[model samples]
Target: MKLSIIILAKTDTLSLFQMTLNCIDSFYESEKNIDAEIILIESNKDYEASGFKYPDVVKVIIPSEKFNFHKFLNIGIKAAKGDYIALCNNDLLFKEHWFSEILSLGEDQNDIMSFSPVGKPKINTSNSSFEIGYKVMTHIKGWCIVVKKEIFQKIGLLDETFDFYFADNDYAMTLKSKNIKHALVYRSHVVHLEKQSVDSEVKSKNIPKELLSKYKIPKYLNDNQYSWVFNNEKNLSGFLKFHNKWGSPKLLYRKNKLADILIKGKLGYFNRFFLRLKF
Candidate 1:
């Protein structure tokens, strides 16, 4: 296979199932020429037993462990036969000719190890580390990115300690440490249905039902399901694990050689102690 698209299916609700199906359908519609396979990592056993039909070509794997983002991603990557592997979300719409454009860019550059498709709402700010295009980039759209299989051999697997968040930061930092190139290919595009995976508000507020409708989320969904419900605690642990492994998030994005030196040098004793104190 040329590419393996790994999508995690967490269909605890009707809307979630529909979104996953939509995402899968969009991929089939968009990429007719590519020799690609869709690997569905179904995390929810309840959904798996629900008897919902998936596309004929999708290869489904039911993990024995709970839904940890990196854990599942690693599983899918291990099973993939493709030279290029896309770690994708269930809540995304693959645009027309997306894979063709990405493949073209990858063919042009031998050094670029990974690629992220352009999304609807672009990153708000640009810095030395964060930019979109066919250059070496420190930033990556973690929601959906295609990585060459060789990157795994060089950087090793993603830190499975991250249950929900900061794994992308860890990977980006790893790429930076190795000086391996990754880029945002604007020619390739995807629509990220952000906050659809796990929505939470530390300071709670009601989101208008009409807004939910825009994402095709049923307003009738229980209020508890709307936010602060799924994986918040696990994601918190992921935050701590990131700091424990890579130190402060601020240091990860800072615009200086010192920050890189500090991060790449490993967290000093005092820094580690302070992180524990803060956490």
Candidate 2:
């Protein structure tokens, strides 16, 4: 099946841009047969106007109105022509045979909604081959993942309300709700320089506010269930550190509690308490 790779980006640091380009070039060299195209969703008009050049990229201009992650993805989804679409963060540098590994998974499994590697490179790779139920609550990082085009048609685009963080989890949950499978392509490795695409200044100001105010754990998820997705150690720690330092700790704590309740379930109470203790 043909694949279209969408790289979500803004005007990022020079090093990040080079890293992303290197990854794309590596993929091109290794997976020559895959009909791949790169789409760059630029948030800066000036950056877009500069006309960055890459061999296979089809540039799509996004006005710098407000940064809406889900909306940007929807735009790219509409433009994608491949049967299988890969959503990759601009901060990622991929392994040479990454596409080949993902393609191999798709060949064996037709019912998969999406597929991703088991863990982030460097942090953990021990569980690479582990296979678990698709519905098992866990954090699904969006840095690199391949999805079937039909799954998008079924679930629709990402919920724009979640401009950034929770969108990936929400998409995976949506697929799980329908019993659509997702596989872990252990053989495919992608290095995610997480958050590299975000402008440091904007991120310092906005991301905390968004997580504290705009982000809410859906009512449908129970405490334990919610904790699995939102209260995971890394997610909670990162949020606490950022918001506590820049924004209102009290408000963030309350919001975090709500997130624990809605996403994690009753077990989230302890999870939240534990996270607070660590922080």
**TM-score, cand. 2 vs. native:** 0.66
**For candidate 2, lDDT tens digit of each residue in 5-113?**
8877665456655766776676677677777787777675566355555454555557556777778877888888888888877776667677777777677767656
Q: For this target, which candidate reaches the highest lDDT against the unseen true structure?
A: 1
Candidate 1's displacement at residue 234, Å, is 3.8
lDDT (Cα atoms) of all candidates against the true structure: 0.71, 0.61
TM-score of each: 0.74, 0.66
Task: Please report the candidate that would top TM-score against the real structure.
Answer: 1
**Candidate 1 residues 160-242, lDDT tens each?**
87767677867765666555667787667789888586644422344455544434232332456435322344444455566
How much is 170 displaced in model 1, in angstroms?
1.1
Q: What is the lDDT of residue 101 in candidate 1?
A: 79
Error of 2 at 34 (Å): 1.4
Instruction: Mark the regions of model 2 whose C-alpha exceeds 4 Å error after superposition.
Output: 48-52, 63-65, 118-130, 133-139, 201-279
